[model samples]
Target: MATSTAAARREEARLAYDAFLEECPTGQLLARISDKWVGLIVSALGQAEDRSLRYSDLGRKIPGVSQKMLTQTLRSLERDGLVTRTVTPTVPVRVDYRLTDLGSSLGGLLSSVKLWAESHFDEVSAHRDTFDRATATS
Candidate 1:
């Protein structure tokens, strides 16, 4: 009885996930993953041979990222179980961030997207300029 009830609940929850829906929970996830800082942070950590980086190292690697934004981004990643935050006990204490298995899976896909964007920057900029000029005339 209890087993069947739990299964039913699980099925119901699964049915509720729909990324195309305006109010779906997955929409929030999309927004989180699509954030600029999130992409940069994930890319930085993902490219590491060890897939780990300290907070300070991440700050240095990603330019223009505010301390508060980094803190927030890391917290969100940790909360979503995408990254693992480890702390070491020491005189000053040490903290490190690394990709979990799930994060690692996303790393390759996001890395590809980053590469594509970098490779196409000039072409995209020209298109944007053309669009802007055409729109300005209208």
Candidate 2:
């Protein structure tokens, strides 16, 4: 009786997840993963040879990221269970981050998107310029 109720609730929750609906869990997840910092961090970690990098290394890799923003983004990723944080007791307590299984899946998708942007930026810019010029004349 109790087991069936729990199963029914789980099914209801599964059915309620619609990414297009802002109130859905999937919608919230999409919003979280779509953050610029999150995408960059995931991409950096995914490209690592060992799939892990020290906090300082990440800071160096991501340009223009203030210390506060980096720290906050890392905390949010950890909370989302997409990245794992490991600490080693060394001279200064070395801390490293690696993407979890979920993060790896997301990273692959985001990485491809990044590559696509790099490959097509010129075309996109040209199209934008054409649109702006045409609109200016209208």
Best of the candidates, lDDT: 2
Candidate 2 lDDT over 15-83, as tens digits, reads 799677667888888888888888899999999999999999999999988889999999999999989
For model 2, what is the error of residue 97's alpha carbon versus the real structure, in angstroms, after optimal superposition? Answer: 0.5
- Candidate 2 stretches greater than 4 Å from native: 1-15
Q: Mind sharing the TM-score for model 2?
A: 0.87
The prediction achieving the highest TM-score against the true structure is: 2
**Model 2: lowest-lDDT 10 consecutive positions:** 1-10
Each prediction's RMSD over C-alphas, in Å, is: 3.6, 3.2
lDDT of 1: 0.92
Q: What value does the lDDT take at residue 124 in candidate 2?
A: 100
Task: Count backbone clashes in candidate 2.
Answer: 0
Q: Summarize candidate 1's per-residue lDDT along 30-128 as a digit string, tens digits.
A: 899989999999999999878899999999999999999999999999999989999999878899999999888877888889999999999999999
